[model samples]
Target: MKLIIAVVQDRDSNRLSQALVWEHIPVTKLASTGGFLRAGNTTFLIGVDDDRVEKVLEIIRKNSQVRKGWMTPHMGGGNEGDGSYPVEVQVGGATVFVLSVERFEHF
Candidate 1:
């Protein structure tokens, strides 16, 4: 068994969930927040057979996407009125972790 942890942006969560369900992959979804942007994120916990790991990863890769956004970054001890500029940033991607499970049980 393997444990797949996928942290995706909220924008992609619905689409990813639907794709996973279509592939008959069971997932446990949790609401989470991203550290960098402090934006909403969704965490998916999926337990699957070892051979199915690649399939699950492929699904996540296909659904989660990276795009650009404008952000006003806080500068040197100043407020938003302190001449802040909008910086283009990359967002909307998934952070995935795959681990080998020693055992798995369901009741």
Candidate 2:
């Protein structure tokens, strides 16, 4: 068995979750926040057989798309040299981790 952990932007969470459900892949969703951008995110936990891992991954890739966004970083300690401007950043993608499960049981 494999455990798939996917963290995706909030904007794409709903669509991704819907697609997973449509494909009959059970998923658990949790509210999360990104450390870098302090932006809203959603974490999905999916348990599936090894053979089905690729299908789940493909669904995530199709639903979560990478896009550009702007963010104004906090400059600690008021300094004259610190530029407080919105910088373009790449966002809206899923960070996934596949782990081998020693045992899985459902009641």
Quick one: best lDDT, which candidate?
2
What are the per-model numbers of colliding residue pairs? Answer: 0, 0
Q: What do the candidate models score in CA lDDT, each in turn?
A: 0.90, 0.91
lDDT by residue (tens digit), candidate 2, 47-86: 9999999999999998887877887776454665577877
Residue 57 accuracy (lDDT) in model 2:
95
Model 1, C-alpha of 63: deviation from truth (Å): 0.4
**Each candidate: RMSD:** 4.8, 5.4
Across 48-99, the per-residue lDDT of candidate 1 in tens digits comes to 9999999999899888868788887875557658778989998678999999
Q: Model 1: clashing residue pairs? A: none
